[model samples]
Target: MTTFPQHSRNFLFTVLALVLPVLLGAATILAKTLTVSPTGKIRSVKEAVRLAQPYDTIWVNAGIYHENEITIDKPLAIIGRQQAVLDARFKKGIFSVMAENVLIAGLTLQNVEESFTKNYAAVRVRGGGHVTVRNNTILNSYYGVYLEQTDSCTVSHNLIRGNAKQESTSGNAIHLWRTDHINIVSNKVSGHRDGIYLETSSNSTITGNISQNNLRYGLHFMFSDNNSYQRNQFMRNGSGIAVMYSRNIIMTDNLFEENWGAAAYGILLKDITDGYIERNIFRQNTTGIYAEGSSRLLLKNNEFRNNGWAVRLLGSSEDLTFEQNNFIGNTFEISTSTNYSSHNTFRANYWSSYTGYDLDKDGTGDVPHKPVKLFSYLLEDIPTSVVLLRSLFIDLLELMEKVAPVLTPENVLDNEPSTRLNVWKS
Candidate 1:
């Protein structure tokens, strides 16, 4: 055994303690690879993904790649220089990422298959976190982007659209399941079953998106809690949006327009509780706001115009406040159920149907306006009464009901109404 001197041993230990972390970091950096084109060696995208190490970047050229099921198992960034197309030819998903910290950007994904059993998406992220999907164009897929069992993902600035005629096997544009902390921002989504859907998700923020022409709700949320949706547009869908079976939600500054069906509503709240719905616009829908079995909701500063009904309450709601809203050009301002009296209050709202004269001119209506129309009560009992909507006999009956309170609920009235329209005009 050879023994070192005391001074030599001390110097060796000091050098090792100073240089060990730097050497380990250098090794980690060397493990990452950077791929570039014009090298004439990397031929295909599949070859690049296979040759990529962890934390690698595969820079693709501007061309069409006819491929399907491009599985990404390593944490790599796949970027395109120009307009790179990944055409799936209606076969399967284009990109399937199962690794964390992956980035997919500046690519056009198209022609994903429509499957009856599986959700064939253009990009499917499974069990991945910290993934960023940005600046992509996804077209004609069953689903544009599908996330399952993922967390802390960011989907931003993507254009996703599906063919509306293919309704036999339609999916959502951005479908999320059992995920959390998802940030969906500035995406244009249209022509699917639902534009954006969140199921069993929590703590997600969906903002600055445009969703239109969907067969179902534009933004559908179910069993998701503690989510916030703001500054989105929902237009020309069967139903504008629906938030169901959720609690502690916040919806602000969303636009709902032209969702005109017999049962269509600008926004539907079913079995939801403890939420804030503020500063939304509902225009030209069959119904502006529909609530059933909901409680403890605060609605403020919303605008309702050209809808069949401004608000509909189905007798199961309680502890709701409708304040500082504008109800204009609607056939009916509100409709209430005949079975039970609701515990909701409508205060300080501008109703175009208010007929009471304010003699004192204090910027408030002197007498209350009973918003529940007589025909709405008849529709509740006999659903066929909608056929006589514009008939003269129904108008006469409505006049008679106004003279004498007949079928409408006594407490369903809006008092202290605003004199001017509450138009945000933003």
Candidate 2:
């Protein structure tokens, strides 16, 4: 008797299968958009966050929201409209996002309270992967964006500034610890202890950033490897950039300028090996490039202009090559060890102070030019002797030392100097 209704039963089953999935898909999409507004139904950002599901987006309205310890435990997109301000003056830890696949964009985070025991930050990403933080302004915080044990994060197009007058209390603009696959691009960081500090980070790229007026080094790397820095500007910093105990690094096309101090340098390489530094510009720094305990490094096509000393190598550096570089308008071209000859080579470089003859009509100078002046070696040994830099007596002593080869290293000279200037008009 039931076999009479077989066609109706089959039609009902087909309708249920198709309609069920369509309704579920629509409900899931609707659950992903969570909006926060003062006049809307979702009153506060915290209330909107509680009602949000995974992969949801919480859009904050434009106003100052004083909150305490905002936590993001699930995958969500927190967006701010018209540069909404999130002031955490009374809060201990401002924003701690601990999940993966999170995106925080277009927000202004300011006034994150500092602590002695805890290292608080404006935005702390802990154990997150595939996170994106873009187009945000983070100011007046201990640390701008701190990444701890995270991977595959992209931080770009952000302005991070901190209080520089309070040196003991201020933190770095961007600090990365034990992270990998990080790409920090197109950011402006200033007025902190250090602009960017990377420790135990590897396989990262830092490009197109401006780091200026920091208390310490603009870019500091410690125990980091396989990292590349390109097209960044370091200006008015205490020290330009420092790389320590790192290997296989590539630093190219960067501008290190105005990092002038009593003990400062455009780039400081300490215990670094197998690195390439090319096409960089060092201008108006105390020492353009200073190396200590570095080995097997290649310095090529760089411009050292208007610096106190173009290059300074301590006795610990060995097997380094300084080739095809332009040393122009510097107080001293090279300063090296006084007693022993360095195992470094300086060939085919344009030295502005070279006055040797080119008798064979070739583009290279016929006679070798002693780059390390005796006066420079004296200044290195005795810092107070720098007062005699422009004296005629010091010039006469330098000329005599160049001809007789005394007091300074004998083999630390540029044998094949370029006849024409290696001007980088670009």
Candidate 3:
């Protein structure tokens, strides 16, 4: 070990303290602001970028500028005064950022080009870190804000609306590829192929977003891990959200509602492990949650209501626990295949259809509530038989099977079913 003398260390600290402020002041002095307006000398944003230096601010005044394929290669803040518009004219991408510490805010970008072999974005940040795209409106873009191979970036408070009609041509609203530690917050996305799509990203936060009326999943992520999604609304899309091939996910306090289609689900979890899902509302979807090859997941304090099937638990899932959730007004509470082994547990949940009494005043039913109905299991094999759902003969058969516990999976039951609604607390 080498040690400095006391006077030597003190002198070194004194030198650093004297020089650091001058360097910081020099950086601040070098960062200049350039203004652009329709009537000004610098009328075009591309020309403003060409005139500006690194760490400069390009302030675009409120006007319409027809520009496309504007490449930004230096660190800069491209801010708009009011809601300045960038019209791409359906030619190419609006802003392509390849620099660090870049900020693009308070701008409306529209008419990004649609390409068969490329993804044209309103604001594309590629291979950069500490970038932010905030308070912007993206209209009719192929991809609203695309982040690729970036870290520590944020996309927040942006409204991205696309006029997408089909999945073959439309791109995602917010697309992330090979990024990490990104924050996607408070954005509204609609009419895109996917509202928010992530691929091979990790350690990110997605919260307070509205994703609806899209052609595909509202939020879709694959091979991303250690991510958290909270307080987001996913409604009336082709499907709600798809989380696949990930591990250690935290999904809580989200609303999944009215995503109605034959193949739609509130959430599709496939090949995932070690996840925590709590306090989410899954309502009026074709299926609330469909889990396949998922394991070691804790689903607690969730509400499933008025869906065709609340949960479709496949045979490959194991070690899952559904605790303190509410299942109400669903056509089928749970549906499972015949080959499904009872490797999951359901405990202390409330069921609206539960008729058992709590004789000892324990607030739990004396008899167990079987959530997986025989008819639902039959529908797994014969989906066409759902037309006979409300008939008297089907009702009698369901009644008989409930009393006998036949054909339904024996272990799939809420042993301590709550007698009342809203019994669980956060």
Q: Say which candidate scores most in TM-score.
A: 3
- Looking at candidate 1, what is the lDDT of residue 345? 89
User: Best to worst by lDDT, what's the order?
Assistant: 3, 1, 2
lDDT of 3 by residue, 1-426 (tens): 999999999999999999999998999798999999999999999999999899999999999999999999898999998869999999989999999999999999999999889899999989979999999999999999999999999999999999999899999999999999999999999999999999999999999999999999999999999999999999999977888999999999999999999789899999889989999999999999999999999999999999989999999999999999999999999899989995899998889988889999888999998888888999999989989998898889998997786788888888999987755454
Worst 10 residues of 1 by lDDT: 31-40
lDDT of 2 by residue, 321-387 (tens): 9888989989998987655456998888988888888898787998887888888888878989888
Model 2 alpha-carbon miss at residue 308, Å: 0.6
> After superposing candidate 3, which stretches have Cα over 4 Å from the reference?
1-6, 14-18, 423-426
Q: TM-score of model 3 relative to the true fold? A: 0.97
Model 2 is weakest, by summed lDDT over 10 consecutive residues, at: 417-426
In model 1, the clashing pairs are none
Candidate lDDT values, in order: 0.88, 0.87, 0.93
Which one wins by TM-score: 2 or 3?
3
lDDT of 3 at 94: 97
* Stretches of model 1 off by over 4 angstroms after superposition: 1-39, 423-426
